[model samples]
Target: MKTETGTPILWTAADAAAATNGRLPARLPAESSRAEWQATGVSIDSRTVQPGDLFVALRGPNFDGHAFVADALAKGAVAALVSAVPAGLPADAPLLLVEDTLAGLEDLGRVARLNFRGKVIAVTGSVGKTGTKEALKQCLEALGPTYATAGSFNNHWGVPLSLARLPADHAFGIFELGMNHAGEIAALTRMVKPDVAIITTVEAVHLEFFANVEGIADAKAEIFEGMTTAGTAVLNRDNPHFGRLLAAARTQGLGQVWSFGRHDQADARLLDCSLHATSSLVTADIRGERVTYTLSLPGQHHVMNSLGVLLCVKAAGGDVAVAARQFSQIQPIKGRGLRKRVPLTKGSLTLIDESYNASPVAMAAAAAVLGKADPGAGGRRIAVLGDMRELGVQSPSLHAGLAEPLRLAGTDLVYCCGPNMKHLFDRLPAALRGRWTESSAELAPLVAAAVRAGDVVMVKGSAGSRMSLVVEALLALDQSSRAGSAVAALSGS
Candidate 1:
């Protein structure tokens, strides 16, 4: 939100001094001393620190951000908020000595929320939280000035950082809260205290931290921990855990419980949804109101989550009709459903990049999208997949379970990577098996070689699997091809 145009004044040096009770440098560094001195931006990573921004030095187990205080100052950071000063820092480096930078960030976030007189929405789930948050951001932006969490900043550190960046004039704020264990969502929700809370869907994700899927559901239900007294809880009724989630919300004294999904009983229900290669046409009944919209993002999962988004728009007193139309403009996010046309010899190759993160439910959903896409005349639908980590002892079964979705998708070839994926590769028919490798880096070349003109390829895996390397390699191949074409054109060939 720290642009030249928008209101980005979260705090100034004087303001931060008052907020944290810290002291400024006795001597001003003449270069940027007169550069407004506003803490217009907040960044933890010194690498991304901008001029005149406040850098919070956060200490972690591996690398302490305080170690980079000098680096941040050199990168044009106007001030530093730190618990401890690093050796060799200049005497003129502006500083805010807080007891703990994490706690300080949370304090600033609370201050931002206290002053924000807008609809605050919190989104969480085992899957689709990023997609839902992004689509909802577009919807709310269409309705009014909106501020949403950047990317999937939905963790212990990310949530507070996002909240602290919120401008006071924002009409809407969307926070994505993610967790891998119990009590994580509870704590984040307490900080968010959303006016509209959305639990996208509870699944067998992060089962390594819980005893069972029900335990995961219980942890997801903790999103209601800090709901506003009159807030609404939006859920996916089609999910089996809907009953339990509803009960939990009711127990929290939430009066308005709107469920969005394929179930006919859902308050915000999908009446009909037609999934296309890169988009979907959806008709839904939202709070007894019938509506239809075209969603630019593919897959039924997005359609279901869009219903929840539209309902949340209405709950937040936004223009549901206008917000619903915004769906058509919502494009796929990078490493989620980002689609690209990679230049090839005969034609162009279609690449669907779901390399950011994955779970069983998400993988099945992506595969379904592949099933629906036409591979064109001579092209084949190829899935370049990798491991879905953190499924606990059920990792093998879960990996093997993807075979059915792949088979049903009519996938012409499958190139899998990672140790857990070996189980899936073993289950695949010989004709369907493209190749298998112990790591994605090793499989990247094989996948690149298998891709042909007009082929549709999808790459997906968890962060641990590093499937993004494959995505990058493919993109680079396309770029090199483009350069070659430019050279040919220059030679009049």
Candidate 2:
């Protein structure tokens, strides 16, 4: 495993000061020289600061990061970026003094992009943004040193942080852009200025803020704001909003637009797919060449997203055949579709952890993947679901709408939680309803108790729904069972 000690020095005091337009303390410690100070990495959290990290003290409404500047410095940080010095720190400490730490971080990101000479790609969508971004990263890594947004850090602060951390010599950079309201992507994209922009697909996500799906599509289209007529735009041809997105890209003066989907006219077209419980075999035509590969991730959603990844690789001048071959190495990210087997007293059961987040479209797609799995002998397919938040007035109907998909998935039993998911529970047939509760805390134990050997279980919901609690409870069963076995052996001895 790679450790912080192995990381190369990423920033120097002189370069950082020039990038952020920040100033060093008037008088540094006698032993400390500006040219001698270096940071191996950048961090925002004091708790996770490494020995040579440059920590940025960001202030928020509920918490002031200035209070942790001393703590970060004590934890081996080379220096801290601060709007104002903390009470305990000396005026001559190794610090980057800026007007505002957040803006300073953004400035560092802007300058980093300006100095970078590599090909950059930005991805945005209601769903599949992170998955597609990760896929692109995996493919691009085979060709050169690649930098990508960590996890799902694609927000206002996350994008800038990812950019600021971009190494000066990387060959490629992939970024994920997300939004809950209008114009968010526009600001982030202008900072990115990607050479290739991709919209995996737009759906009824973040409807709580938008008037409808069209508005969401328009918000996603803001990713084009940073690109000029020379750059390429990648769209999902199978999506209903494809025409809208295509028009928007044209309006933004993008000179080239490439599309990926199962549609006949798609530039990167999926010709066929053999979906399995944990992986799939896909054959697609990129431009005019036929390419086939195996994807380790389950679900048709991922297969479709893979097409977009190829288009990005081609647009960025990467070897299409090499990128296509890297698909087999890509695995499912945690809480998205990560699958594990839990050992019970007599046997084991499969657990698909999709608890990180949820949406109507994502929920339906997950159900489709579950339907493809072949449960063990006497095992049944089960679902434990919580609410899909941020749906506005359609929350009730959207929750209830999941009943059809779950039923079609051949789910034998279900555990439901949250008020919105109660709609789905009530809509389910009596024989299919295992339990229902007002919260995941209340539902976790019930589902954990009811699950048995020979069961294929899936737990999923929005982050706010805290469905991960239920997943934790289910996993804890294995630990308790092992403890009991140990106790029995000790008694016998």
lDDT of 1 by residue, 284-340 (tens): 988888999999988888888999999899899988888898999988888998999
lDDT (Cα) of model 2: 0.91
Clashing pairs for predicted structure model 1, backbone only: none
**Stretches > 4 Å off in candidate 1:** 1-6, 21-36, 483-493
lDDT of 2 at 6: 62
In candidate 2, list every pair of residues with a backbone clash. none
Q: In model 2, how large is the Cα lDDT of residue 9?
A: 63
Query: What is the lDDT of every predicted structure here?
Result: 0.88, 0.91
- Which sections of candidate 2 miss by over 4 Å? 1-7, 34-36
Q: Please provide TM-scores, in order, for all candidate models, with all chains considered together.
A: 0.95, 0.97
What local lDDT score does residue 43 receive in model 2, on the 0 to 100 scale? 86
RMSD of 2: 2.1
